[model samples]
Target chain A: MIGAERVGAAAAEPSEAIRLEGVRKAFGGDEVLRGIDLSVATHEVICLIGASGSGKSTMLRCVNLLEPVDGGRILLWGEDITSPAVDVNAVRRQIGIVFQSFNLFPHMSVLRNVTLAPIRVLRMSRREADVRADELLGRFGLADKRDDYPDRLSGGQQQRVAIVRALAMQPRIMLLDEVTSALDPELVAEVLNVIRELAQAGMTMLIATHEMGFARDIASRVCFLDQGVILEQGPPQRIFTEPREERTRRFLQSIIEAGRM
Target chain B: MLGGGRAVVVSTVSTIVFFGLIAAAFLFAPGSAQVRQEFFNLHDMKVALVGDPSHGVFSVGEAFLRNIEMFLIGEVLILALALLIAVVRQLRGPVFFPLRLVAIAYTDFFRGVPLILVIYTIGFGIPALGLRVVSTQSAEVYGLAALVLSYSAYVSEVYRAGIESVHESQTAAARSLGLSQWQALRFVVLPQAVRRVIPPLLNDFISLQKDTALVAILGTVIEANRAAQIYSSYAFNYSSFVLAALMFLVLTVPLARFTDHLIARDRRRRQAGGGR
Candidate 1:
């Protein structure tokens, strides 16, 4: 069982969990993340929704400090993570990331993939790491694939292994960037099943995904991001049936209509 | 538009005309003298023909052939040395600026200068500094040493370019999995790079075949070109020289085709997303 109190350190209140103010990032002339402010609460699964190139991925990346922000402050569990003196690596260790492409190490076995970071970065002994890795693999129903390489597994199996890898690190917050986007239509459910399981277990998760059903079903709150801003947000049921913002209503209509026709 | 009979007739006529011109030029040519004196040629070097040089063209000595074989063994050793140096240089310097700089200097010096000059400098000039001319087994050794020294530079850069052709993402993926830079290169990059470089390396090996001719300048008697010189001097005949030319083609052409086959195989494998 996880220590829920520390986990909520990641999400005490919408204001206290992740506080970002006037956050900005740019590469050359293009500014991807403009000045923005947002908060996420404890025991919450916040789904970031947006069109392509709308900066939803960048926002998720920012939370993990995978992409450094040029300005503003990112506070994780009351610690000012944006300070230059802060060890970004330590912050990264607490915040785990899973990418859309399922960037699993191709050269490692499925078990090794889950075990490497714990043994290397966490400095866990090999035997202990192996023990933890086996337990995790069994939970994900990948015990048979412990010795198989990433290339040998199905895309769904690989992504599940990826999630287990992040989970093995025991991160306070798990940042999932379109985790099922690369999966085949039939395979998407397998990966999403694992994500749903994590959300139910009270993982502090921020997911950038296109699956509206997943957002409506599992998300505590949903934020529609467009042009690098949070256009609108609310409870999944309210946003789905009674969106107050025009942009959120229009986005929902497009997806529902696309599904119908 | 033209048919097969027309092609055959044209080929037969051209063949007759070519042979006719050759016969007319050689047989009916003016003042082609046997007037060259025997003193102009050293018949003793004709030792290569009968594997002997006891009294020159009229005689054969097995000792000369043995010396030539000894020289050949030495040159092979030199080639091995050069290959080792090039591979080591490539493996050592994919990232370090200083290593790259040293590589650039090596290839630049060797490629920028002529091979004959490199051979002569190592062959004769080094001996003037008390290197003692390496007259026995070292004759072949010194020639081959220069050959390997000159060629290794070109081979190293070919390897470097092959290494770079592997995408940066491959390394990034490996490192993200907790591998160090060298480990990433060793486990991910170099294997693919080496496979891709095989055609160019084989091409390098072909160049090495002809480059062996440069050893003649250093007085090694192992190789065909030098053996040609020895045969011509002893019997005063040019047939063996022709035979040596034929032998070099026999070795190089087939090897080059085999290398081409490997290149094509790798390209096809890449198309299918197989490992390099």
Candidate 2:
């Protein structure tokens, strides 16, 4: 496809951690991600806030190459990852993702869950992986749960373990897909606290979230996605308090009325 | 006191009637004479225990041992072949389409053909061809091969169902972690799938165990059923068949109960919030 060649002709943007150009994705006839352009700079936390089915999650997924784009190129540090020539696993190694459901490997112990990709894919020795896993678990207050299965942990603890699992790979960027969405209200803060720490530590992150206050606090930029397009994007203050588009205004109004913002 | 006493009397009368009818049938029924003699006579039971000497060389114990040997060999092959076929069927992407189609055809052909016919062909036909290696093997080997061939088709279907039952989200989660599709299956999907279908897999094993009786048709190996056939033909008493039936029950009933116990235990664990 010319998609790959066109991406090569585009000049490299070294400062961008991730770049999506005219990214289009569809599930059969239903186009989920229409033409979109977004750039995430190094160590910048970009929060995607929109209603369900607005393609916020899809965009994050595309960045990690979890979902292939139909017509666009996603560049990871200036390499065209969406090209057919790219080794997906190599690209994915630089980008870690955590899901909403806390999709921890249920059959593995908490320690193994964190160490699996490292030990298997990254070829880290078992002893080294265990040490790294223990350190991450200890830092997240999950040290006591190292031997426990995913089901044994509380929702908040499971989410933290999931984040640890992704972090063990030492990826360049982290994609958090509504990480707190599956958790109970009280459990949300524990997970948000972990993300807050990661942001404070200057980890590059692309987060899809409904946690408005979190977006306000953490995001360098907030992008409002509506029907597979970015309707407006700017500093969190501008997007949240002074949205440029009517659709963005109505969405924020509903969120405010629902006491969610 | 009279109302309570009447209920007690009714229960006692029902128990007595049930046992009374069983006793009367065993003691006085016309056709029961042969059943009584064949099932319980001390003389016939002694002969059945040793098997009829003129028609077969083995005792019933030896026959039972042969059955056990075949089951052990056949079961191992069945498990391996079934899993191989299941994996083949589960192959995805266009590159594997031909192999997948072949696996589909293999299951359909074997599942549709009668197990007895498969045994007859492989048991007799393969040796009749007089080729090298396979032809030189004993009819008993052929019988075991046929058992594996037929049972693998059934077991592979069971494995397929188990694999399919695993949620797509699990695969997605695995893929999101940068695991290859095969790695995802090996580490995440198959374990859960296999756990979910243990009861059904055991059910298929039970059927495979019973079907081992068909091997007697080869006439080259005298297993439990073959011993019963020899005894029934030579001794003119069906007690040997009854003995064989009891032996199968002795093997299968406990397995069935064990499956039930496992299902109950799994349910309890899930209810206790150990669910994944």
Task: Give the DockQ (2 decimals) of all models.
Answer: 0.16, 0.55
For residue A227, model 1's alpha carbon misses the true position, in angstroms, by 1.1
What TM-score applies to chain A of candidate 1?
0.93
Which interface RMSD does candidate 2 score? 1.4
Model 2, which residues run further than 4 Å from truth?
A1-13, B1-23, B52-57
Best by TM-score: 2
lDDT agreement with native, every candidate: 0.72, 0.86
Clashing pairs in 2: none
TM-score of chain B of each: 0.69, 0.89
TM-score of chain A of 2: 0.94
Candidate 1 residue runs with Cα over 4 Å from true position: A1-19, A39-44, A62-66, A75-95, A105-135, A146-152, A165-172, B1-172, B175-276
Find the 10 residues in a row with the least total lDDT in model 1 chain B. B35-44
Candidate 1, number of clashes: 6
The residue-by-residue lDDT of candidate 2 on A42-159, one tens digit each, is 7789999889999998898888887889998888888899999999888888788999988887878999899888888889999999998998899889999999998888999999
